[model samples]
Target: MTPARVTGTPGRTRVLIVGGGITGLAAAHRLRERLGPDAEIIVAEQAMRLGGKIHTVDFAGRPVETGAESLLAARPEAIGLAEAVGLGDAIVYPSDAKPALSLGGELLDFPAGHMMGIPGDPADVAAIANAKERPDNGLPILEPGADMSVGALVRSRLGDEVLDRLVAPMLGGVYAGDVDRLSVRAVMPQLAAALERHARLTDAVNEIKRPPSDGPRKPVFATVDGGLERLVTATSASARAEIRLGMTVRELRQTPYGWEVIAGPVPDPIKIKADAVILAVPASPAAVLLRAVEPQAAAALSGVAYASVALAAFAFDRVDLPERSGFLTPASEGKTVKAATFASKKWPHLGRRRQIVRVSMGRLGEEALLQYDDPTLAKTALRELGEHLGMRLPDPVEQRVDRWGGALPQYTPGHDARIAAAREALGVHRNIAIAGAAVDGVGIAACIASGQRAADTIAATVVAADR
Candidate 1:
């Protein structure tokens, strides 16, 4: 595709951001904050609406999330952004409901004092423990600059029962990835760092889980009362950047003045010129856009893999569920549904007018289940829920299935290295950076931080050019 003619006016530092998800919107907001009204910022989203992978819809006459339901408030990015965008008062925490685990067709309480299913105290999981002894002495000394699979580390240090039943279910719920392929450093950095200092895996987990101070503890997770999608709307409004929907960026090339973004339909594509660019899309599209400008970066990004999962939201008229919030099924159980969340119970703001629950299905190498029609997929989720809860669910008020294809980024072993290589290759270019779940952590907090970092980098470049 030929480059579209440059329309950027002189004297103004034009910054073009691709993708209008939370990452892109966050970047735009940061850019506007740093550069003020002097900078011209534009965001192009291929989708018709904003908030990628964060969708909320009207169900049972109430706003229910079809995608990401909560934000990790432990990190300040998401909470800070929400407060900045005037959503602080709307923030709501989960109700007092503990999550359970589905084991041997029985719903059991998920053991506490564990870091990602790695129990600090073995007695907490005595019911499921198969290992004869807890490695109290600690694990082997982990050398500096060494990385291994989380599954391998847990299995060697703890046991297969711990890895399969506890760690796998918890981590799998977040990443939808296989523990054997997930990176210890990337997925569980704190534990990885602790391993270097302590010989035992349990000891490391215990140290990591220790409270830093006696300060008032914050909620583990939070979300806007209306929906997380409201954060997107508020951020986009605050950024005040020109948002172009249904605009697909095809290619990127460096120009003498700055950068040129070739986008729009193939038949009649448009070119956007900017002094800086923030690529905040997924790995596949980012790879395609960077191939022409930075081939090595493109290659590194291409190696990033993604996993798709489907959420089936069901609103029941009358159903009896345990007082607990939800349950997670280990892959070892050979279950189709990985996890289920009792939305109404977890989020009190969702209200008790209608019982709302979400069933999540799919994992790494489980794309076949996603091929089924929405109805069929919903049925599968309901069936699994029935078996796990030991009660037949009566479908009633509303039901919806939301499919997220190529959504969750898998951080395999050496994931950080690949990201570093991509960033290093792109360092040669001026005012060009990549941001999103692909590079940073996958949580909302991480994505916001990554976007802000990209914006800061480009803003600094613009200021340097002015000098």
Candidate 2:
């Protein structure tokens, strides 16, 4: 890869990328690979550091994931990227099957016969009753088999006992949002597919559960040995683009020849010019940046909203919680905490006897316990754990709090349509592109895929220029 250069000719296409998150970094790396020694690319980051929400911290000698913990099993994109960066040997899987749920105040094993949150037929499980079913009355748990929210779906199929008692809490731990609003299509499409095909979620789950034959098995969950930040560090080292830290792009405008960027007060704030631009920032910032260049695109970008979130990681004696690795709380119970993970139990290498526990609170736009002082938040989190786990510890050895103001875009029912319209409008522009988790799926894999595709688009356009 060659260093980026600025050329004044209209034909020489220089690329500018906004945002230093995973998507932006991945785009920069891909651009370097495809453009070889020709194109000039620059990346600008608002924050002091890179790797937006992919945060991992070391507390009391244990690795705690303050943000995203792992990538999905079926998705190859994240794992592939790790391999490309030579971190493949660091992949580690956790015990996902050990997860539990907290109801009213009791821990319940999640019902065994369902896919994601959706159940097969509520009638099939003898212990579980439909949400509409009456203890002794002549009514069913809910309106007969009506499509509903994940909360309602679990309630109707697994019974209010399972919905409030189990399912909701488990989901709360992962998504940190109102389960009712987190669409099955967006969060768990496989479970949704079961609902669409088998008419009962149980049948779909059962089909996937054939007894395991003797064969090689792969790990279901994975993370780098050094930690997830290694991926970011590696990408940054290999990127050919001119990456500048602490530079915030305030706005973007198009010129007859190419594009001009307005960045925060650098020596030459308005001098950065590019023939093409990739807006890899979150929807909130991307909306503001595209307004002048493409109003329709800006409107679409702004329409995609995000939820605020906070995470607290605590380290303690490993034997504190002897139960399962971790669990979630259901929304129906109206609890402040969304989920909790038992780190020492989940990852043995985190500690032998000293343990790490991570508690995540609040969804997009919700107030989190992290808003309080560190001691107050830590105490509050442990109290909830004691109540749910029926065990208590003196105090946490270490505590860390991380807050994301507008992260993780909520994909509502019409999300796909809005994104399609935004992309269509963007097509009118000659060298503008958009890439981020807001358009594609969330998680590390999705971000990498989005970034790589954006780079491909630029590479294709440049090839056409030569023709």
Candidate 3:
């Protein structure tokens, strides 16, 4: 069926942003800032609520995150946005707590000076390294602009023990991806850049880890006192956009004057016309929407894979746990649980309330685990937690299982090139832009930056057309 394009009234420009996730809402906020109150901005979210993966729920009479708990505060985008949305004072950093790795039935401190499990100092990871392994003679040569799987690169330089016991666990904690397929350039760009100049991987990592010649060090991570979702709520409330929940955007087509977004249910779909559009949904949905307008872009986006994972949050009345935050299980350990974060121990604010722990499960090729019922998944997490702590845990006072399907985008080898191709194809349409974790970085800060950049690009293109 041909999509109908409705025209906006004269002198007014309408911007329609699809997805209504953090990225989409950030775009809306940026649009309001750039275009002012006069410009019409609309955000369409298919889900009943906003924030996407940044979901928080009331547990044991206190708010807790079922999805992402903290924001990478090293980047200014998230902190800047928080301040803009009147949530500056509510920001809280995690308590000083060390993380450990679960290896060979023991919890050991994660090696120091490592980036995503890639050890900067070989001696630091002696606990996990093979005693029989000899010292590295030299790092393998990587051609300029070349890319390889993070696992392949690490294994080649550091050996199987480091790749399996160190790198995979760390990378899995973030991406829920297999190190053998994850891209070093996309996931660890700084290290990849440093590798081009240095011959040894450890030297490159050390260079990347070097402290900058600047002022006092800032907190690396932070979140709202109540919940990270507060940032989403505050941003949505501050944005001047008309947010429509349960509104699915089906397709996008260019119009003579602007762009037409075909959205809503099939039986009674609505065509909304806009001077510009931002596609901020996941890669799969975005691919379908862009297939009609930009096939090449869609093809590139289609190649982007995603990983699904589940979080099981448990609250206990009285339980004994270590002083450290949590422990991560390497894939080679063959554990059902990937990582466990002791919320009560990690956050002082929560520690004052009740003992709560969050267990994460699943990885890139572990979709079958997600098929299990919520109760079963929770039990799996509980069992794994007991095994890791080496104690028979009592029944939890409260428990919640939150499954996030396709929550993380896998930045495999050639990810940057694929994104570049899609952006080039999309450049032909000045009034349209794409932004989200799929094309850019995955962290909250990166998503915020991507959304703001897309908004800026669209605003500039529209202003140029008017001039």
Q: In model 2, where do residues sit more than 4 Å from their true spots?
A: 1-13, 121-167, 190-217, 266-268, 368-370
lDDT of 2 by residue, 1-467 (tens): 23223434455567899988889888988888888767777888888888888866777875567788776655787888777777778777765447666766776666655555444445433343243332322332223222346755555444666565445555655555565566655566555555555544455556554345589556666777656788888887777677778888886888886678878565545456887789889888898998887888899878776776666787775454755778776655565567787876776555557777777777655654446776676666767767777776667777777776667777654455567788889888877889988777677788889998998898788667667
Residues 402-444 of candidate 1: C-alpha lDDT, one tens digit per residue: 9898899999888888888889989999889999999888888
Native-referenced Cα lDDT, model 3: 0.87
Quick one: RMSD of model 2? 5.3
Model 2 whole-model lDDT (C-alpha atoms): 0.70
Lowest-sum lDDT 10-residue window in model 2: 136-145
What is the number of residue pairs that collide in model 2?
16
Scored by lDDT, model 1 comes in at 0.89
2 against 3, candidate with superior TM-score? 3
What ranking of all candidate models by TM-score puts the best one first?
Answer: 1, 3, 2
Which is the winner by TM-score between candidate 1 and candidate 3? 1
